[model samples]
Target: MVVLRMTKKLPWLLVFMFGTVTASEFRSPSVAEKGPLRYVFDADKPGSDSSLTMWTAYTSKSANKAFINHGTSVSELTKLFFNESEFRLARAFPNCLVEQAGELYSPLLRTTKFKTRAKYTECSCIMGARWSCPVFEDKGRFVIRATVPLRRVEIERTDQSGVRGGAELQDVLTVQPVAKPSTDTGVTAKQSVAIRADFAEALQQSNHKNPALDFTGKIKVGGHEICTFGSEDTADQNQTDATKCLAVVGVDEGLIPHVPSVTSNVAVVSDKKASGSSYSAVPAAGGGGSGLSYFSDTSGTYANLAEDASKTVADRKTDQDTKARMWLIPFRGNDATQIEGVDTGGTMDNLRILSEQVTENPREWLADRGYKFETTSDVGLGDIDIDVGYEHLLNEKMKAEGYIGVRAPTGRGDEYWSNPYQVRRGNGQHWEARFGGTFAWQPFTWLTAKGDMYYSFALEHTEKRCAAFTGADIKNMGPQVDANVDWQYLVVRLDCNLFHPETQSLSSVFGYELLWKRKDNITFSVANMQTWLGKKYNSTTNAFATDEYALDADVAEKYTNSVGHKVRFETSLRATDYCEMFIGGSYTFAGKNLPREQDIHAGINLTY
Candidate 1:
């Protein structure tokens, strides 16, 4: 799992995020000093046209009820919203018939009636009938309606009337406004609010208010207050400007990297059992000087191997960051500054066989026993890279971003790494500059596509390395291997995003990338640490050169290429509007000596 703060750390500020959005202004409401508006119903009002009155029953029932004998008591003044009260209520109370003497009645009216099991309570023993009446205006007081009492109740005990009756009641109430004799009330004219606030003042206040529903701070009486206020245009403009900044910069480290310094520049040779003592002879038969020592290699096998692995790791990390930046551009829309990241640390691990026979024939005892010093290596390498970029929305259909960054010299330039198995780790101590462009298109609500192209140019680091041995001993060394080294990198990735499950900002991506690199003036001989003597000061080369080795630069070319594909699934969490988290995992398949890998990453980002 990879976790990162959305914001970069500043020299004086230790913040995990730098973005901020002004939610709302805490303004105190001013005491009203003006009169309020007067509103009166007009003929154009909705209900004033017909004023039809309808009586409908609301019902509530249990899914299943216990059965009771006939003539069970039922309560009046009960109702239900819908017939389907947990059970198949529709089947129980089918559509009602509405007609007037063979003439179809108005569909808007509930001009029908029916009786069903008890509702308003879960008790099964009780039952009641629903009575409904339509309010169709026939322009007369006479109406066609059911005779059933509007409210009736059956009780366990009978009243003096002795008709098995309990109670029959119908109640109604009316409200009358107070008369306007001189004044309706004593305090109607004091401390009144002015509904007709100046439009300019309202607009100015809305710029500071969180105008989500009330875009205008002024109160309006247009039959109803407009919750989707008319001042939204100005409020939106202000919100947009609030997030605009002159520049945005980021410095990052690790995708929560777990890579260890598995490989060091130091090499250890032991003289244990099965040692190459048979072949390990003293210079001139103990003619003094048979000690072992280590020399630096900027183009040696282990260094190059570890360096290549590190490059692969760094490349993948950069790709992840590119995708992250590209994905966020749409989320941020046009309210963004320079979206950039300067992240460091990546992981590199490789395995190399350490067989004695692979480089040199061991001693007679070791050869007879078929014994050799062999071990597999697990090495780690890392580096830091920076990107400062800007993105622009070309149109609603497309967006583009460009960046120029540097791969800083963050790695141990020399052979400075932890050697776990006498293996090498630190790549060349070098730095490079990168230029890249990203393009994205959203063709549909569920699909998005992205493309990226990048090029890197590295500054060469020249250092002498142990070369091909001219003999088996520490003497009789060959000419110095005056090797030169340089490198350049080119890569491109194509990514497509697929819709995620109900999550609003979630997606899955499928991508393919091709990486090409050129390492000029670099090649190594078939010399192992055990087979070669140590390095000595070479006056001819004016650099450190081995006493018994010469490097070969003609066996290889300066260019190498690799291709890889990745499938990643990422999703946005339902977090606060200002804070968002994205997490994903990808599986990579590569070719041409490149290792396959799996990566899990997540990061939190904030937009002001």
Candidate 2:
């Protein structure tokens, strides 16, 4: 598994109100608040844009899951297979005994309603063969069928010796039930019982060939094939219709050359330091504001402006403004001067506003300005991604793999954060379907290159979001309104490595990664907003009523599509047969609507 993270050490203030509400006057808090009539500050800046790259880098780390041609890990030596709970053995011939043992679980198996092996146990075979028998009692045979529940059973052909007939079998088999299995003889849905090795032979012959063989069969869903299943003839050692056994998606044994079985477990940890500066969108040249600034100020005075433009009595305004503002007294300007009708005292840093309300500064009240997350460090698990697939070694110099995965929204999403600046540990808690491929090449003894490309299709979900009045709720102290959001992401990465001759286990790896995210489409009901605003102001339901809701096209347009490119360098040391350590740093050199940030990370890889 791969993990990513970021920090939220805010350095700027954003207390502006949304839309047209005038509470109090103060300087703009961010460039997003630079112009008049633009009240809703892009509060999602810190948690969005370029900062999102950290989560995507997990795809780069997934390269480790690719299949290598050479045998190196324990998964290549020992394989694990599960049984189809309803598989059976009928017509017990005299000689054979089958034994299944292992403790393994697969998400695919769970989805198929197939029983998974939970422990190692030697159970009796239908043939009355002795338990733990090293030898057979009689020279007879039995055909395995899927008509009965053998539950959590898998057959490992301990002997590579071809059955006493003209056929061979792969080492591992997933016995799945067949419809109307024949009890009279070696027949399952009319499939011949004689062990067939065509699939296995092709798998073995394709080892050193170019354009590696394709032995996987299609797995269809809703009339579309979305994944593949191994075709290693598992029905009583006879080739079962691959399309029929969707639960047996993987036949780990014999998939990769010289690897007896395939199973891998990995753990990763990444650290991202808080950044004081971030790249931000600036008004285009000649399009308005000054040239772009690589950094944006996140702190400053904020104003809550409210207006009832059409409300008047004999051309005189009669609207009461209830917008409360937070004054940053310590950060006042140096040019302190007294106003004509208002008494301003002391230096600017120690100044005070003498209004009838005379409320204390934001610092005095624990949450007077706006709500903020606790500054203390928070640690927790991130979203969980389960990937399953197959890889084929094309030749001595290259290999390729295809896979599909699902991301579980188990981590904290935007709604869980106290403010927009706080880091959201998950991708909005939206289930995602991810598919990708990895290709690798090793042309020389000291050089290797690998590339990975993947796309994530985020499902739309309904969640609560900040619906502040005006833009005053910049600190996220607004009403929570249900919003439906949809997201999609695309990523590609390439890595080149140079190995040391003296220490083949050490290598210098350089990589470039790219990510593109489609702008999110967030939709909310205008009626919901009208109800909230009508209840609060009592007479402005008409003002809040509109065809385009506050968070509709306008707010969505502000974020646009985002793109980022990052380059990194790292040194990897294979310290032991089962362990490797790496340390690296990355710099995102260019992109739009992305944070131009740098990060350093270190982690270990353990294989068994």
Candidate 3:
């Protein structure tokens, strides 16, 4: 048995010794005899690691394919980043701003087979693609590093009368990190291209530490919020109730104002209070002013001021690019059902403007009181307001401003509703004066607070007349002289900034409007207008086309005790140094049988 085992193992041992001797005695082939070889490294593979050596791949075919794939992915990702960057964003995709690879990329790749746990600016299956990347700093300088694969490079092989050059591929892979001056914003093209060039050169140099991971991208911070409320009126006087609900959201998201219409549209505020100053409102003839006019709208529906005429009063346009925030509400059929029922929303395509009618000279901007200014509103049909105010910087930590504004009856008011209940006052032109001030305090970058208060007084109307329309006399109705009425409102709001940064912020705003009113009942018949138009009272589409409706009764509704409470939360993202995007929503609890009004708006503001 021992002899047989030794004989069986003897042949295996002899074969192993012969193979070892042949390998040891054999001389290495020369470079001319054998082809050069290299292992390709890619971290995109399933098991790729931070260690460059571990990422190395065998087989030239796989390496070549990966090289081209990496190049293509990098190119495509660069293009995506360019589009999302602040400089050339023609269309914004905030929803696609940033996301994880596994969720957002698989579909784009058209296959569920590929997914990654890596985070990316947008989703894609190709590996090593990035944008809006976090800028890494070494000391005070921005460290820009790029790892690029090179097929070949040409350098001068000889300097003769006739130029000569030689091309060569890298024999080894090295790494080098480049440094650049940091901008307040993003990476420069020179930094990107130059660092990329360094990647190629470093690969030819002796092996060194792997270059810092390269990320060419940007960052943006933004969010949105919505809220809602409603109420009816009852008189409650001498109430010093300060219900404090402090919140901080953001700064004024400035916007552009709408241009005025060419039609004869007039705006006015209404004051039917028995205890306050009584003011009359008048509709202009192919004209415009601001006021309040009311009549018994028996049907309880009314027209939209925007449908009949223009609804913007750009009091904030400056000589520079108009940094103005304008409210754009679309109005369809006139009526509370159409306006507040929330079904008749249109677009801001008919953005119109009602200027201050003040001269264009810069000197005209200054009134004896202060400079002209405007604030944003979450109200319907927006406002045609003109305010003259002075702002003073009390100190580094605080500032104060005061203004007296004349709200042109030029905005969409209560009278904008369709008839039966066309008792819409705050229509036509009844100029009202408002005294208000803003006090702002910023204790630190993370915190800020502001107090805003205003009181509006109904001034006596320049003219007073009442008109009545009966069944057939809708077109030709004479005006009758009528009398005195009064109305006013007081408002106070507090705003706080909870999170504030150069590129992002959060803020909260809460306020209340207290009303003072006592108006006689206003009654009007829709039959007369329907008869004139030769259409049924329900032919709402045509009946509201014209702005020539009037009332049959001389009384206005009494809303002695009314008030509105509102809260708004807003957030902003600074996509770039000059561009900011913001969104917010608010619900107003209005008083005196008024419906709760809600508003939500979002926009991007740009500065040159």
Best by lDDT: 2
* Backbone clash count, each prediction separately: 14, 23, 71
Instruction: RMSD for all candidates, in order, please.
Output: 47.7, 41.0, 41.3
- Tens-digit lDDT string for candidate 1 (236-330): 21112212101111112111111111112111111111111111111111111322111211121111111011244334233323211110000
TM-score of 3: 0.28
- TM-score to native of every candidate shown: 0.33, 0.40, 0.28
Off by over 4 Å in 1: 1-382, 413-427, 463-483, 500-503, 523-550, 555-561, 565-569, 606-608
What TM-score does structure 2 among the candidates reach?
0.40
Q: Which candidate order results from sorting by TM-score in descending order?
A: 2, 1, 3
lDDT (Cα, tens digit) per residue for candidate 3, span 507-601? 33333333323333333323222111121212333222222333443222222224444455455554554444555444443343222334344
In model 2, what lDDT does residue 591 have? 60
Choose 1 or 3, whichever is better by TM-score.
Answer: 1
For all candidates in order, the CA lDDT equals 0.26, 0.30, 0.24
Q: In model 3, where is the ten-residue run with the lowest total lDDT?
A: 21-30
Instruction: Name the candidate that leads on TM-score.
Output: 2
Q: Candidate 2 residues 1-608, lDDT tens each?
A: 12122222011001111111110000000110001100011111122221110100111110101111222221110111111111111000001000001011111111011111111111110100000101122211111101000111111222123312111122211122223223686433411111111121111111121111111223122222222212322111111222211111111112211110111110000011113311111111111132211112122111111111232321111111110000111110111121011111121111111111113322122133243323222224334444454444555667665777666665443364223223333556788888888777878768878787789887998866655322111212233567687878887878787788775578887878777778767666443342111211112342222221233333322333556666867776768644556666665566654434344545554322
